[model samples]
Target: MLVFQLLGGDLRGALGPGWEARIADPLLREDIALAAAIDPQQRSLDARSLAARLRGLEPRRAARRQAREQALQARLQAWRRRRELRRRRLGAGLTAVLGVALLATGAMYLKTEQRRQQAETATAQREAMLAFVTGDILGQADPYDSRSSGAAGGGIRAAVDRAAARVDARLHGDPLAAAAVHGMLGNIYFAQDAHDRAITHLEKARTYALASGAGDPAGLVQVETTLCDVHRIGGHLAQAEEACASALEHARRAGPGARHLATLKLGQLRSEQGRHQESRQLLQPLLEQDTLGTDPRLRGELHWALGLSARALGDYVAAREHFGQLLQVAKAMGEDSSWLGWAYNSLGSVLVETGEYERADALLQRAHEVFARTQGEEQIETQMPDAWRAEIRLLRGQWDEASAILQRIRQAWQDRLPPEHAQQQRIAASLAWADAMAGRTEQARAALAAVPRRNDPAQARARSSAWRTLRWSRVALALDELERAGELLDLFEEELAQELPDPHPLRGETRCLRSEWARRRGDAALAVEGAAACRDSLARYYAPGDPRLQHLEATRAAFAAAP
Candidate 1:
């Protein structure tokens, strides 16, 4: 019981209470005896002794609890260390991932910005180039219109020069734009009859246009065609032909309208070369198109070309009709006096050929007035009409008046034209004719010798040669050099046959010369027959009161009355 009480708590307190009652249970007594046998000290312990013993054991239990607490604290510290290590590793990996993401994003942004900057730069450059190219076109009046005169501050030539200078300064990198500017300059110079300057710029334009891959093919073709025209006017036929052929090929690629322009240019070139049949064939179909009538510029050009070709072919009716149409177009378009003057001159020249002298004279006078007003009286345009009028005077046997007009034209042309220029040659030829007609044989021969021979066998050259030969034949006959006269007449006839077919008006003049030669040779019957044929031919071609026909009629009468 005492042991049981000590095991429960302090033995003295337990014994005071239900110690005896607890010990009275047989199982309890047996447990207490077993405990006593194992632990005698515990069995012998009283309340005071047990209390002292329990107090002694309290320190060891406290020591063990402290040890367990220390172990638990150490384990918790280890777990915290492991958790902190894992957190640091995770943070470092996240930081690396974030840094890479930021870098990639920054690189992407920079590339995008760089591309945008480049795009903006390209757009700016293109805009600048476009502005440079279109400035002249937008800022000025029409450069090609003769009636506009010019702007308030400057004329077309000055404006074009300023624009071209700007282009050269600002548009060096843009080949296509530069090409367009050069072409514009070329047209301006060509209009002013500065052929050398025109050719220089046009050739440059063509070169740049060909080099620019993205250039407008139609525009390139137009530049080439303009180059062809400048070269043609400058009398570089081979270069003009080459340029025209190239333009034609490019025009075919451009479209039908461009091709049509190229075709017209080629036809004009052919006409200039005196291949009148080919020119007529090439241009006739285009003229017949109903659509072509609506475009006055095109119609006028076609009619002008047709008129020139027809006149060369001795188709006077067709020539007159074409010239009439051209004049109508000029009037309809409200063309300036310069254009009207040229149209009137062309029509009047054809009228002269067709023996409508009165109408021809009226038209020629009107043309002269227009030219005098528009292109100064001393200008080539005015001189041309004056020269034609002088030819009319020559045909009427007003030799002094004809000589006076020829002298004026020759002096003016010599002052203004190059020594070897075609116009100068024409003036020289005309002066020679006048001198021969006035019976100044030596002066006539000297003037003829001064006219240079062109190496080309072109129709213009052939015509000039024929006229020159006829004048030489007349001069030889006046000098009584019969053999030389016969030789010159033969040469004149050959050139006429080459340049004109039978029944041509020019052939009547040749036949008259032949009759005069036969009369000088004392072949009365031959002279009579030749004179009769010459008179009939002249009547068919010349005006009713033409002096050449009157002279032939008198010659026939003198032959018939001869003893």
Candidate 2:
């Protein structure tokens, strides 16, 4: 235990350095180490016995102990050198890893900054593009540089083309600019009624707007309204309705009165489709306001719409009342020629339907004169004078003259008007009737076949059934198919009765057809019944002196004489 305590205390005291000094004798360190290893539990060694062994030791054994001590000292030095080398290598490796990590972090931060700057630049460019585009629109300036620069004969088309070109130029290398330009182009195309081109541009604009993240509600509404117009013009009624609905919904979310004009358009669409109740419902509230009511022009427009809707619903009294109100509004507004012409024509039609043919003739003539003054020698379809004159000619039995006038109208309208215009259909129907009366049966058939069919639900609901039955009856009569004509005329009567008012415009005509059919079949009682109904319906719309009523009376008398 004493020897063990001595070795442990001496080793611990010499922990840092000078182990050779602590040994005192050169071979003592090895002897102590060997003794500790061999018999550690033998705490004490005999000093006299160690000396005796040393004295008796062989020369070779003493040399071997010295060699063993030197070898153990060499091993300790080699192990320390290895540990120092390992530490230096580890420090170099750590430095390299930290340097790489720092460099990678700096590079990532730089790349992120570059991306952020690029995105900001792109956003700024988009804002600029929107400003320029919106400015061009609101300015109402000539879009074309040349047109705006005072070029002669600079039409709306020239202006739009110029603006479109400029917008396209600014779009170079700019996706957001491209989107704005597409929307602008769509607007131009829509103005020209180039629906296909408009659709292409609008769709492209929508894509770009979404891509550029410029999805403003107002901007979306503008684009949607244009698309709606295109669809409406194309006779895609359902699509148009959807577009309008979307626009209205968006407009409501945006601002007050934002959709006032859109609502008017919706009302017009409903009127055209024969939804009189809905049309009235939509416009009536709009018209009740002072802003719409007191303004002569707006009032006139409201009354005109109301009259037309009433007319379509076969409410002649209400139609006449509305038309009269429009006439008074026009006079009060000092709207002299074309506007008055329309009001007069509408009034005249109502009067004619109510059997006031003499009064109707005066109003029709007045409308014709007004058109001649305003529109010159050429009569446009929408020009009330032009159509009212044609109507007058037909009512007067000038079949050949009416046909010539309508054919001329058709030629003029071939390029100028949309294919689905209601006036065009009316003109075509009149032409067909004129041809039938003129004994040109095949020509009449062809003309009748040319009447375009409307898929708009409102229009179909309004007149398709009645008109179809009437058309078939005419066709059968033209073919000398008496049995077929009788059946079709009965169908026409029934269909007309379902839709028309008691004093409808077509009541006289329907009765005359039915009377004729019954007389042909030798049904005197039915013939008399139809003739009486015809006279009653005629008296409601025309005065006693009206030429149309007189002619009808003559026809009924002749048929009665046949018995």
The TM-score leader among the candidates is 1
- Point out where model 1 deviates above 4 Å: 1-159, 162-166, 335-337, 375-379, 451-468, 475-484, 523-526, 558-563
Taking the tens digit of each residue's C-alpha lDDT, what string does model 1 give over 1-563? 43353222121222222233433333334444544444566565554654454344435445756897799799979977985786687886577675776699789879978666644443443344334433553356353554423344454445555565566666678776677667766776665556777788888888877887634677688888898988876667788999999999999777787888899999999987767789988999897774355456667888999999998778888988998888887675443436678788888888766656678878888888887876556566677777677767766767788889878887776655565555555556666666777887798777644433334355344335455566666666666767767776776676545766677766777787788888889977777777767777777666657666677777777767876
Residue pairs whose backbone atoms clash in candidate 1 = none
Cα lDDT computed for each candidate against the true fold: 0.68, 0.62
For residues 1-563, what per-residue lDDT tens digits would candidate 2 score against the true structure?
Answer: 12222222210121112223433333444444444444556634455554444344345455876897799789879967985786687886577675776699789879978666655554444444434533443244443443322244454344444555566566655655666557667865654445677888777765665565433445556666667766765656677788778778777754544466467667766776656678888877776764464345556777888888887767777888889998987565343335677788889877655555568779887777765654443445244444555666767778898788788778876765565555566666677777887888888777644433343355454345464456455555655657767665665565545655466656666787777677777889988998888888777766787766777788787886784
Candidate topping lDDT = 1
- CA shift at 518, candidate 1, in angstroms? 2.7
Off by over 4 Å in 2: 1-156, 165-235, 289-300, 320-385, 416-423, 448-479, 483-499
TM-score of model 2 vs. true structure: 0.58
- Model 1 gets an lDDT of 0.68
Clashes (backbone N, CA, C under 3 Å), per candidate, total: 0, 17
